[model samples]
Target: MKKVILTALMSCIFQFSNAQNDIRIGGMLAYGTEVENIGIGVNAEFPIIEKLTVSPSFIYYLPKKVSGVSINWFEFNGNANYYFLDEGNINVYGQAGLNYTNVRLSYDGAYSGFLSSAASDGRLGLNLGGGANFQMGGNILPFAELKYVIIDEGQLVLAAGVKFNL
Candidate 1:
């Protein structure tokens, strides 16, 4: 009876330890001069399994143009992140994703030549970064992150967002 009880207790503890899963919704700003120019985005993440998360994001930007003209672009993207070190208040991860981009250019006031020109493209890239989470109250983690990715041109994206553990 003692042996059976010990085995059951160990199994319960192991299962509880493995049940650490969560989802996060947040916003970010991204810049890729050769592509979307500049964009502000919102993103959400869900952990499908241990150490891996699936994220989907959307971004919108208006690029400064010559002669009072500006261009607008929107991007839809998804990524998979693998956490290499998941411990304490700091975590390290690597990510890869695909982006579907819609590019539009517009002119105002004086420039008549530029009028809502648009282009759409698909891009694939990889990202790597690490972040520290500062626990602010229960279930809320304020984090600072730095990541680099390449979508035809190289980009460095720095972000500060909150993570919600579900």
Candidate 2:
């Protein structure tokens, strides 16, 4: 599954890079509501057509301690954004996409004297969101977005950052 997704993303990036001049790449800070933790991520957007763009991002959530277990999580998202309003310096858009989340947990032997365990789980989900980007200059834009992932472990995520036009 990882290989397949990587291949598809690389292919799209190559095609988009060759076909467009408005590609943007950036890093972001994110907050995940369900996990109750902060995450750091990076993303890229490729213009697909007028008023449409393909955006993909990956987030690595900071580890958290819950009760006695240490928990860690991360996610990958691929979304399509449709710009409904673009007023020179500001662009507002709606987005829908796919999500993949993975979580890992570790337990220490403090429970007993020899009861240590580690486990991980992965889920596939769908994402729905909206966002806006403010063009700062000829080659910089600041953006913010909010999205909800629909899955067994649904979570709302908010992200913001600056992007550089490449």
Local distance difference test values of all predictions, in order = 0.64, 0.92
Instruction: For candidate 1, give the lDDT.
Output: 0.64
Model 1 C-alpha lDDT per residue in residues 38-131, reported as the tens digit of each score: 5677777776666777878777765666555455656676777777875666666676776665556554533465444444455566555544
**Highest TM-score model number:** 2
Clashes of each: 0, 0
Residue 80: error of model 1 in Å? Answer: 0.7
Q: lDDT tens string, model 2, 50-103? A: 678999999999998887799999999999999999899899999999999999
lDDT of 1 at 81: 75
TM-score of 2: 0.86
RMSD of 1: 6.0
